[model samples]
Target: MDNRKTPIASFYANLQVFKGYAEKEYLPYTTSAGDVAALDAALDNILEEGIETVFARHDRIASAVRGSAQAYGLELFLDSDRSNTVTAIRIPEEIGALRLQDHLSENYNLLVATSLAQYADVILRIGHMGENAFIDKLIYVLSIIDNGLRDLGFAGNGDLAQLFIDIYKENI
Candidate 1:
């Protein structure tokens, strides 16, 4: 409820897990002489699994929102008892390290309808890197913020939330 205090601890905790995974499994395979062929195969597997995990997580949260919406109606939107909604964009194979790096600058968004679907009342997320150095780290934290605030309806300061919602609506 303390929106004034950013979720730094939560962000760091998720970031560490993401960093460890990259250091242990992702980095060596990509940069070192540790079996490039095997590493490439593993990377392929990770990507497939990662994409699946992202969507599954989002679906789960969305479902919760729908349930709450049915029970609580529009009041569900302002409730604090819900989990956060997080939607991950599909990562294309063509996106290299540099593109992944730049993606860090873009804000991620998920619509209120997603939360309304499950009656979840809240949304949350974790982001893993694409292909660049510490890219996953940045994504992990940003996702936390994106989904955290989205659930809380605190995505932006003042009218920023309305502005973002408008943009999101236009794009969709």
Candidate 2:
């Protein structure tokens, strides 16, 4: 995800896999053994042929989109807060992408917290727990400080991103 080229293709790849099962088995939601087998076969095809085709198509699509974005000197960014320092760039399509990224990040944290909280034994075994640590504590902390600074209208100088690392090394 840190990669400049986001895993949008991964979504497409997974969609192809799901599409196969949806096409074969859920032909009306009435379950049948034969239908199940057909679904399995279709899924296998997706694993074999459909995946490759879909992946390639998505790769091209992403390349095209990124290239276009670059062509205009546009950039995609996530502002820490709606009002404050303007992190705006020329990137036009990025507005939607940033919203989706933030939404997904929030959803992923909630899912992790929910699952971890449900497993009490696991939680007890690890005394250090919270949304911060459960779902990428380092990234969470750094992003928070980073976002906080940005939200305060202070542009990053790349120092805040290294605070946690320095603290870790000092304690070690």
Candidate 3:
């Protein structure tokens, strides 16, 4: 009754296939055609836009998000060298992360991430990636966050959307 030889274990096994692929010697099975087609389409889009351009866009959007958070008097989880895909902000103790998240989603039709484990309800994450990494989209999200915070009794220091536009324009 060895687990290694069990049908369930076999179904999940991939080490052999991985080793073969790594050696450039074998393909254990055919890849899903739908997945391949989707990947091809995604790669085509990236090539059409240029990889560097995409990276630059992500950088610009992330920078703007960080700057907007700062302008709103929100503290970033990481003070320096933050990611170019997402920005995590400390939720005001008085306002609470879930309150803000729900406010945005219910009122503005926007969704934001809350930190996990010990940081849950302490931090909120805003992601700016791929199609979401655009000035217009970020502006809308920032505005919603700004309003949501105010609605939850947090007095922001400045307009988040305006700050994002200013920062994004400077980056561009």
Candidate 4:
């Protein structure tokens, strides 16, 4: 999460012996005798694919967010050169972090928030992970921020929809 990669975790292991069950399964996890092998294989596949596919996804989403923020003249609190899975930015003083989060969700049906305790009322976080990371979804995230900033009376660089398109072209 700190790295901003998907909250959706990816793991890889080549264990010689193991008990197989979904980690999400409750304690003393039990499955029908015939299900263990299938479950193990599925878990393995998911982990492998996540590593192979999701890092590229993280890069693309992170770049889009960074690019959009840059175009809008918004400050991203994290290191600009590093690519992270999460996009964290200080919610401008006029728009409190939690307040912005609520407004975004309520008005745009986009769910975003501050996940770290230290940033609770300060930095707002947006996560782009797994298959959920898509260009349209990224544009929506930026639009919500741009609209929120405008509604709060923050003058920013104009419409970001086209910026998203340009970025998409560059990325593709």
The residue pairs that clash in candidate 2, if any, are none
Candidate 3: tens digits of C-alpha lDDT, residues 34-114: 988988987998899999999988988898889878877999999787889999999999888988888888988888999
Against the true structure, what is each candidate's TM-score? 0.19, 0.21, 0.80, 0.65
Q: Rank the candidates by TM-score, best first.
A: 3, 4, 2, 1
Model 4 lDDT tens row, 57-155: 667667877776777777777775664667787777777788877777788787787756767878877777644477777777777777876776777
> Model 1 reaches what TM-score against the true structure?
0.19
Residue 140 in candidate 4, Cα distance off native in Å: 2.1
Which residue pairs clash in candidate 4? Answer: 4-85, 4-86, 5-85
Candidate 4, TM-score vs. the true structure?
0.65
lDDT of prediction 4 = 0.69
The top-ranked prediction according to TM-score is 3
- In model 3, the number of clashes is 0
- The 0-to-1 C-alpha lDDT of every candidate, in the order given, reads 0.36, 0.37, 0.85, 0.69
Between candidates 2 and 3, the one scoring higher on lDDT is 3
Model 3 TM-score on a 0 to 1 scale: 0.80
